[model samples]
Target: MPYSNIILDMKGICKTFPGVVALSNVDFQLKKGEIHTLMGENGAGKSTLIKVLTGVYQIDDGEIVLNGKEIRITSTGEAQKYGISTVYQEVNLCPNLTVAENIYIGREPMKNHSIDWETINKNAEKLLDLRLNLKIDVKKLLSSYSVAIQQLVAIARAVDISKGILILDEPTSSLDSNEVKELFKAMRKLKDEGMSIVFVTHFLDQVYEISDRITVLRNGKFIGTYEAKKLLRIDLISKMVGKEFNNIESIIKKSRDISFKASEVNFVKATKFGKRGTIEPFDIDIKQGEILGFAGLLGSGRTEVAKLIFGIDKADHGTIKIRSKEYSYIYPLKAIKEGFGFCPEDRKVQGIIGELSIRENIILALQSSMGIFKYLPMKKQEEISEKYVELLKIVTPSIEQRIDNLSGGNQQKVILARWLATNPQLLILDEPTRGIDVGAKSEVMKLVAKLASAGMTIIFISSELQEMVRCCDRIFVLRDRMIIRELIGDEIQEKNIMETIAQGGISYGKN
Candidate 1:
């Protein structure tokens, strides 16, 4: 490849924040008409590098060359002027605004020095048609559309700017398979027209599907860049994780085969668990010692299912029975009192207490369960913290260390410890291993198995099919807000789960 054809280049980029070197001597290049993917475990400096390139952060040491010209980009506007735009995972457009208004917010087409609504809508429609494969109504309010449509609208707006590079940061996180296919088509169209694209995502399959080349980052350093087609999935994973992927499958199978006699007691039983317009009613049973897995594609209601069980949202039509007593409309406090613990999906937003010390965070759920005024004695609190710190192997200098100061993996462990300390009979873990490293993920999975073995009922939710297959004795597959299938015994495998998700029907076990 000719280096002269590079449209964007960063050399020896170094960024630091307080105690962390976010990025160190990283070099990245993007060529015109190519989709260059940035891949790494979360907090591997992918976001930091993007921030540096997009003018969100000024690099301490490095040079950025756009179109062979070295220029200073002190703000987002300056970066946009050089033809760089970013669309984050969350759609940042104003939801209340019309699609047309969102598309042309700052640079509206004007008529007679006044806002030109008609021409703006017409122009917005035209611009969208050029980039998007779907027909969207420009006059519709953004909130009226689904997440996939809103995301496409965001991309359409970015395409209208006609600039140097476009960065798509986890654009398909909430999109379904069909929606992802549509977005990929739009990306290809833009690439054909000579747009340099920087794609950031955790989904490995997507990286291979859409990218021309891949750049791997690990722990704030650039590992390597290679042609997408030339790299194997296992090799890519190994690079991202900094080790040979462990034989998680064998371990899980062994754990599953170590069968326990079915207990007469049910820890959690829901007759038709669901909320109207959110999740479809489905029956679920968690025995005293079992790890039940929830598996599905994005927007498949797996997380919604967890929410209903945890009482994050009220179920419109369902009866939950814990220890043979039926309860009506369970709430968070009630769920906790009834021996339930939940570790929500988004760790930063829902799981961690960033401002609190690790010990305090670890004891949050237990404290809530034991009533706020009934604080644990200092000695007992220290003992609880010490036990879990060693149990989960959380990497903190001390239990008193602020949870925010820990790495992503350690922070996740702290959250897990919080729930574990509650001593709940049923633990609900939603995407427990998300954004963590391989070693940490393995550790967490092993812990789940151990907990189940120790008679703690568990419900594990993950977007990764292989993880679900390896971790649970039974798996529930959901699609479009409904439970499509359930897999148990020997049927729990990656291929079967993917097929069930694709077909939207139960093949392995009865509903």
Candidate 2:
């Protein structure tokens, strides 16, 4: 609570990219022996602040004080030298190597000019079991354990390497409830031992549960820092987004002018659609002007179903009909030509082309549908990009700026603009709101609802069950690559969806 107890203090921090001010005179302070969480929406400079502190990026102008002394960290090695270590969401470890080797890697103990196998295994096991309460055979391969376990192993290694300060970035994003509890337990143990931790996560519940202090940042500026218990969740969200929280009802009010109901006409229909080793054969008829959702955990065939429907992955067997026209063969180009657009789950890998300008990225799908023979002129491309930028509220300095210069939320909007340019009858959005901040998520969901109400059919897939409940008109529950049940009307609530997934009940004779 007082500067007297602060172990790490960053003052007047400033980091700038080509056309973006990532962090502008931002300030962050971490108390000794406490868990401090950095909070913000996408592009709010959370990652940039962390990178500057961890030596991934040297600060253009700032002063970093560690242990009451000024320090300049120019590399990861220097950060570690200053007793700062990080464990990212994706565990950066070798799956082929044994846990012991991974923990001590690069600094393994030696015996008579050879590696000391027994001491390494013994110490790794003792450190994990005694320090973190994680009991596992250190001789086993890293891949033998689940993601949760691998995360704990990473923490164990980080603590062993440098326990003064540890940074956990979205560690519980992929873990189950039980695994998250175990992680919290370990974090508490570390904090009790006088280790200060810097946590960065999008999940509010986890932040409030583990953090002693919460720091809010917006538009590359320091908002404030308050004790976790003293900060209300709503107030914290407001600070992060730089606005009061608006409920889903307020977002949908914009589309209230249009009727929000499923029409009798079928937009897309699949009879016994099946993909080998991906998803089971299932019959589905997506009605016009309806939001059909695929709800399930990660790797529950949600993306697979989207892929099959969008012709990204060919269906091994099925009869597909689009607007009552039967199609014996399907592919991406054909799907596009037939008035279908898809926003893929991984925007970085499958969606956005980083080096391309915002204007070029937005016109890609439309140009593809028009074919190279009918290439759009530069003026048309600029007009289309500017139109969507205004329509979708995309924040950009210029349309000619590279898409990579924009933030995560803006990048997602560019992808959505690409699809909207095609004027598709149906849009397949797979995790469209994933990885973005809550504010961006609200914008995307509002856009989805608006489009559906305007007579566009949507097939949505998301891991966030609450999002599916709030946005979907009907939800098809899947488990283990099989369609388990269909939920509609009053049945499309979060509790019911969870129960359905847990019970794995057969519905429509599909499972």
Residue 283, model 1, lDDT: 86
Q: How accurate is candidate 2 locally (lDDT)?
A: 0.85
For model 1 the local lDDT of residue 421 reads 92
Q: Compared with the true structure, what per-residue lDDT tens digits does model 2 show for residues 279-368?
A: 777888899888899986555678878888888988988778988688754889999998989999889999999999999999999999
Q: Compute the lDDT of residue 134 as modeled in candidate 2.
A: 87
C-alpha RMSD of each candidate structure in angstroms = 6.2, 8.4
Encode model 1's per-residue lDDT on 67-111: one tens digit a residue.
Answer: 899877788888888889999999999999999999899998778
The list of candidate 1 runs beyond 4 A from truth reads 1-4, 245-287, 290-331, 344-348, 352-422, 428-454, 458-511
TM-score of each: 0.70, 0.66
Candidate 2 segments whose C-alpha is farther than 4 A from its true place: 1-4, 245-287, 290-340, 344-348, 353-423, 428-454, 458-511
